[model samples]
Target: MTSNDIRFDCQHRGDGGPLVIVPRIDGTPLTELVDGFEIAAGMQPAGDAYGGLIPEFFRFGPMQDHFLGRSTNTMGPKTPVLGCECGEWGCWPLMARITATADFVTWDAFEQPHRKARDYVAFGPFQFDRHQYDDALQALSAEIGSNVDDTRA
Candidate 1:
């Protein structure tokens, strides 16, 4: 199947797990993502794990800087640490499949869990509520203990 074949329909459950990264595929016995959706030290999906899988709905690149600079509402303030090969297109193309809904300590990624990062913007410790983050972290922790590796997916 193609990347488009994988639906981008992530959700943010306020009272659910700290964080979840589900990769669902249609009509296959192996489609259930629960096993695949293990939590990890960091929110890998939003991190470098999924190759910028979801919308970095936190910043604007060149296209945005020119037009939607003001209305643009992702993470912005600019930093070389949070650099992107995509450049001004820090987040773009409005990818339709990898739908992601995050429950952040704050609406801005530039904040929390981030300040902990040596380079806050490019990459850093993603901070979230302990209760929520722990729950998700536990699941991911289990995965690490397991023999299977979903990162290969």
Candidate 2:
């Protein structure tokens, strides 16, 4: 689908701590989508083997930088778009090549680092409107930040 079909949001794991910010696309959790793709391909989904990145990575600056192709941490040309359910990025990752232009941000070349043989070529090359993409990121960051603040209060 084109950028218009893409959206970004967050899902909080209850009692999973204020720092936990699990990203959701449309209304489904990201891990579920990955699992669905795997299942559709006749391969078992990672299930609990997948999860969100650590809290630090969700912050506006780092996250924005990563998506915008300005971050240094990368696996070759692909970036770790999702991480292990254990909260560590390197353990298990869903990598993608993210590209941003003046008006659109595109994500393609998805790979499951540990399952090199599993093909994700048909999964996604989701293109997102730059404005919507940025707004979603900012909103997620703000929501996360506010949650953290509420927790401390």
Candidate 3:
């Protein structure tokens, strides 16, 4: 009985709800994620259950691209963290270099690049030149897209 998606990002760029959502920028490397269980004696319990389907994430372990359990798993030695942000503040730091994939948006409410464009349009007319924003947004989006694809792959 999971709830909704909650996301994590080391390079957090905005504040408040409806963030410029993307994929995870970083997370513990697979080796470290697995080792954390060993170090903590499995006290944390892998897998987020507040809501959504992402079960676990690792940089070096089997859960590399996206996260650990995209849908569900056989229930192994998993662990859960307090999430990258809790309340108005971040409960913990978002680990770097691991992007997560999920059934839907498990954490933050997000959309793809085209969705972002729609949101931009909805924000109303741009007093400034659209060219500048267009170029800038495209460049940044490309950078993020590359990283996101790598993480998912």
Candidate with top lDDT is: 2
* Model 2 TM: 0.81
Q: How far out, in Å, is residue 2 in model 1?
A: 35
In candidate 1, stretches whose alpha carbon ends up further than 4 angstroms from where it belongs are 1-128, 148-153
lDDT of 1 by residue, 1-153 (tens): 111122112333245311222322342111122113212224333332221112233333322121212324443442221222242223422111111235332112332222243222432222334345334435434543341233334
- Rank the models by TM-score, top first: 2, 3, 1
Q: Which of the two, 1 or 2, has more lDDT?
A: 2
Query: Which residue pairs collide in model 2, if any?
Result: 3-127
Ranking by lDDT: 2, 3, 1
Indicate which candidate wins on TM-score. Answer: 2
- Give lDDT tens digits, candidate 2, residues 13-86: 55745355455666677678888888778876556668876656444345667766665666588877778887
Question: Candidate 3's residue-wise lDDT over 15-74, tens digit each?
Answer: 422222222213333223323433444323323311111222322222222232231332
Ten-residue stretch with the least lDDT total in model 2 = 1-10
Q: Cα lDDT for residue 113, model 3?
A: 23
Comparing 2 and 3 on lDDT, the stronger one: 2
